[model samples]
Target: MILGKCPYCDDGMIEVREKEVSGKKVKLYACSNAHWTTEDGEMFELRADASCDFRVWQNSLARYGKWLSYKDMKDLLNDESIEVELISKKFGKKTYYNKHISLNPEYGVSVIWD
Candidate 1:
């Protein structure tokens, strides 16, 4: 069974359910009382199907047909479509972009995933 920890209520987490998505095995786990679940954003952070995070990040970077202007970002990630923003937590946008799109640093732009 899937294993995890619950910082909110229960200490030990266990698998509660399983499902298939796009022909991939997906297991859902819980923290005893089933308050929180292991799904898209919580526990299922890895996609064994994908090559790697770097490749995924690079693809996202390349999706921009051409270098997007500052204002273009606002429209591209609108409320109706998607929400995007620049954030600086551990490293600034400039740093992260450098590592992601090293080939085209000038084309790098931060678009928050929401």
Candidate 2:
């Protein structure tokens, strides 16, 4: 199934490819745009099989525009097709956790919060 658009180029199409990693074959679907290829965006993986029930995973990852807490990072990552990085920030004598989420940089969708 067509999971997502390239998000970088209008003419680009997301495609699936099979590659061997750690001696095991895996299926990967990712955007075909050069920018996405360079930045590693919109990528999904599933084990090779005759059939893969990946729609659920894909659907869950496609939701957006909601306030989410730190506990929802995993779902947010999947939803935005981005990775989350934890950084430590010091305020006065205390340390707080900060989350940096990378979304469409060109569109100003990326966010950072504590």
Model 1, residue pairs in steric clash: none
Clashing residue pairs, backbone N/CA/C < 3 A, model 2: none
Over 4 Å off, model 2: 33-114
Query: Looking at candidate 1, what is the lDDT of residue 103?
Result: 18
For candidate 1, the lDDT comes to: 0.33
Model 1 lDDT tens row, 44-74: 3434443222111112333333333333333
**Which stretches of candidate 1 lie above 4 Å from their native place?**
21-24, 35-114
Q: What's the TM-score of every candidate structure? A: 0.23, 0.31
The lDDT values for all models are 0.33, 0.38
The candidate scoring highest on lDDT is: 2
Model 1, backbone clash pairs (residues 3+ apart or across chains), number: 0
